[model samples]
Target chain A: MTTSQNRSAFLSGMLAMLPVTPGIIPFAMISGMAALDAGMSPLTAQLYSVFVFAGASQIAAAQLITSHAEPLVIILTIWIINLRFVMYSASMSSKLPPSSIPKALQAYVMTDQSFAICAGMFDQNQVPYENRAMFYLGSSVIMWLIWQMATGVGIAFGSIIPTSWSLDFGVWLCFIAIMIPGLKDFPAIIAALVGGSLALALHGLPFNLGLVIASVVGIACGYLTEKKLSSNLPVKSDNDAKERFQ
Target chain B: MSLPTLWFVILAGSLGTFLARYSFFWLSGRKALPEEWIRILRFVPPAVLAALIVPGVIAPGLETENPLFNPRIIAALIAITIAWKSKNVMATFAFGMGALWLLQYVETLL
Candidate 1:
């Protein structure tokens, strides 16, 4: 594709991702504020946001630190929360064509929001396969910028925001919005139900270890459900032009 | 929380996360995973998201003396409906927060 075409594909990616930006704003701000509340210096909080770059995991780590959990425990908890990234990374590998960009840089920028958005675009053929990586960059790079800016603002001014406002709850609301619509197939629905139920049952586990066990059990349920039950939902043949963004 | 420990958490956590994100790409020379792996990975987002969100929404109710009814759970139910109907982020967020605040107000009156 021409450079002009590449530019537009990138722009389309950014536009598609625009609607989802609001979801992360609360999350980034909350994560930033949580770090500060946990007694990390501004520099440390900012650096944590930048380097860790995963909102849920960053917040989880900060909470662990506050309880004076062992450093190894903190790291492992972060890994467990982020374990889905292994799936995301594997899935993303297929979507992204071979590129000149270093593998490390690509991995660092791969986020749940950008990955979900771009994957939907690719599946719908909204953008050319040739430009998949470019579209990904368009979606991811902007997300990274926004997350950092929001985190910095959160660190700088998040203290002023009243806790009673319950802004942190918005993150869960965002995830719900993204997740429910994707419950198209039987396996997907089963996965969600099993995962949700297991999580609640295991809620009292220490260090959020319940999440780890629940996710594994949930995914297994989904896989087994798919194998046992053929999808009854009729397959659509690219007729619906719904732009399933974030 | 010590200087050394703090730095270790950040640096080591970042490295571990990077590995999680990079695991597949670093291992695979091909463009995609085997079809079997793809089938399994498809559920990753759905399952993981469910794991993350469900417990979070219920926690407010769980924490209170009454596990059956709470502002957060009610608000989330409203948000779930909004999300299913419109699939719009702003709509869900707005309605969810609105419901929560309204319920909290009613609770105050009660």
Candidate 2:
């Protein structure tokens, strides 16, 4: 691609993600507030936004921090939560140009929003493979900048807000917002129910291991349920079910 | 956690997350991930969120004696309803926080 074409593609990618900014603002703000409530310094909170970049995991990590969970457990939880990115990466690998973009840059910029935008573009053949890197860079860079700035503003705003306001509730609200959307299928619903129940039952586990155990059990139950359901179905209908699950 | 420990967690977490993101691209020449693995991974998001949110709602603190009939649980139910109906994050936040504040207020009144 020529320089101007690359620039335009990048610009267009940024514009495409513009509408998502409004939704992201509240999330970034809540994350900042939660970090502060979790006893993180403003710098560390901002750094969390910079390094973690994933909202849900950051919130989970902040909650763990507040409870004084061990660092290893915190890291493991965040990693487990982020394993979805591997799926995103796999899906994007075929669409991204093989030889041009460095793996590091691609990995650094990989995010749910950018991947969604790029995946749509790939589906439409809107951008050529050569320009996919520029497109992704544009989209992800804009998102990254906005998230950082939003988190910074939130941290500043959070520090001034009195504890009487009880903004900490925003964190759990954010989690609820995220979780409700993913309850689309039977397996997903079962997974959530099992996970939630186990989390509650094992809430007294030392070092906050209950959350980890619950997550494992939930995923296992969901996977097994999906497997059993798929196995019992006829061949043609099984394919349809698999597609729906995907 | 100490400052160093916090930094270590952030760094280690970032590294692990990045590896997950980089896996397919870095190993493009290798065999693809199994279909079963992909299907299983689909459950991770909801499951993880559930595990996290359940405790936050039912037993926010380790010392909480009662897990039910709390402000957080009530507010969370309201938030879930809004989210399910509207799928709007902002709406969920508004309703959830409003319900929480109102519940706390009523508790104080009684």
Candidate 3:
């Protein structure tokens, strides 16, 4: 891509993240409150966002850590929460900058919102590879900065945020924002139904093992169905599921 | 709540988060993930989300489990239905949170 084209792609990606800012505000606020509720420091909470940007995984890890859950258990839960990122990463790797873009930069921008916008750009075939990375970088920097700021807002004001107000609902709203856009196929539909049912049925399973099991079973069902039903199943790419998400 | 404990949580949480994010990258470099494993990753989001929501929307307390009639869950169902039918994020949030608030209030009255 030309230099100006790269700059425009980056600018457009930043613009895309602007819309998601409104959704993330409350979620991050609640997370800050959660940190206080867990008796954690603001620095620690902010650090969680800085080092580990996955909001759900951060919450899951925080809850477990406060409860004195085993290290292994906490690790497992975070892994499960972030498994989706593998899909994101794998999808984008082939379309990224060839060499000058460092692995760390590639890894950092592999977030849900950034990946989505980047993938969307790619899908539309509007930008070249070099520019795609720049776009993702621009998008992710905005998201990451906003997330930290949101967490800061949460920490500074989280305790005062009223439970009665149900600001916590924003977390669910954010998930919906993430999920709704991808409900595009039959297998995804069936997997969601079946997987959701199994999860509910197995809700009482300890240490959130039910979550892991349900996810496994659900993915298995979807994968098998796709393989059996789709006459032209695409060959498995070099990247695994986790790679795709990352 | 102790200092050591809090530190433990932070350390554990951070380490856990880092490992989870970095693990697949390291593993994928060494060997190819089996095709069977790739197939199973598809259903994870639905399953994990269900696991997260079902417990909270059901009992939110100790003792016996509740069923479909459970008000919190029923309320969530309403929200999910809105989400499915409308695919409107703001609408789904409004309905789901609205239902949860209403249910909680009603339960208090009873």
The number of the candidate with the highest lDDT is 2
Tens digit per residue, CA lDDT, model 3, B1-110: 56766565556655554444444444534554445555555456655655555544453543553442355566666877776676555677778778878877876676
Q: Write the per-residue lDDT of candidate 1 for residues B1-110, one digit (tens) a residue.
A: 78788988999989989998998889755555555655666666677778878887886467564554588888889998988888776788889989988988887876
* lDDT of each residue in B2-95, candidate 2, tens digit only: 8899889988988888899889988874767777777878788778889988877777544663444477788889999998887666788899
The DockQ scores of all candidates, in the order shown, are 0.56, 0.59, 0.36
User: Candidate 2 lDDT, tens digit per residue, A12-121?
Assistant: 87887775666678789878887887888999999878888898888888878888998989999989999988887777776777546587877877777677667776
- Candidate 2 structure lDDT: 0.80
TM-score of each: 0.83, 0.89, 0.80
Per-residue alpha-carbon lDDT of model 3 for A171-244, expressed as tens digits? 65545544544445667666666666777777667765666677677777766777778856654322222122
Question: lDDT rank, highest first?
Answer: 2, 1, 3
lDDT of 1 by residue, A80-179 (tens): 6676677677767767788766778788998877877777778778777888877888888899999999999999998888888887677678678767
Residue A193 lDDT in model 2? Answer: 95
Give the backbone clash total of model 1.
0
TM-score of chain A, model 2?
0.87
Displacement of the residue A16 alpha carbon in candidate 3, Å: 2.4
Q: Between 1 and 2, whose DockQ is larger?
A: 2
RMSD of each: 3.8, 3.7, 4.4
True lDDT of residue B9, candidate 1: 90
lDDT of 1 at B93: 81
Quote the positional error of residue A58 for candidate 1 in Å: 2.4
CAPRI class of candidate 3: acceptable
